[model samples]
Target: MTRDGPDNPARPLAGTDLCALADLADPGSKGFRFRQERLMFAGFVVRVGDEVRGYVDSCPHAGWPLAAWDDRYLTREGDLILCGGHAALFRPLDGVCVAGPCADQRLSPWPVAVIDGRVVTT
Candidate 1:
């Protein structure tokens, strides 16, 4: 279900198997869009170690998704989430803007949890 907000408030995950926890490997990202009421909701998922995090997929610099063009949302080492469009880098822990042009800026975060080996919205 989609929560109404530029605020991107917490919303419960809908359906199942949006993706498996293991599916979000380094350099890989996933996107999901859900509809609720009259609103359309969108988010991106990133895998880090044994956990996963989700975000609105928007970069604070240009208000665009961080990936270059596809699911490649991270640097080669997979520690920093990169916005190839502007060379901005973000910390995975809280989607904090950490380097490049948008340093001190931040990406909007969406709540995520893992259940039954599947990544889910929380």
Candidate 2:
């Protein structure tokens, strides 16, 4: 949610996680947190389909981090990243603002794609 785009060349994520992919077996499910942040990027890995995607943890609503508590990120059918403070729903695919207070505010996705069972965020 900064002044930069998804592919801002900031190396949004350093090392990737494949073991953590199991947490995302359900839709709208997410589990990730950076145990390390070398270049100012807290890596978060999510599983979508058979592929794993990564994004920065910060939510776009009020510059707060996503995940209400624990590893929970709203209900499975929620289909959006629910903000704990103001209840903003952010689309997972493109990180676009979908509903709630910040409907037009996107989650600022970190450019990531699956490559041979690896989730790379660059």
TM-score of each: 0.77, 0.65
Candidate 2 residue spans exceeding 4 A from truth: 1-15, 18-23, 35-40
Q: lDDT per model, in order?
A: 0.73, 0.55
Candidate 2: how large is its RMSD?
4.2
lDDT of 1: 0.73
Q: After superposition on all CA atoms, what RMSD does each candidate show versus the true structure?
A: 3.6, 4.2
Task: Give lDDT tens digits, candidate 1, residues 19-89.
Answer: 88777775467877666556566678887777688888677788765676667777888888898788888
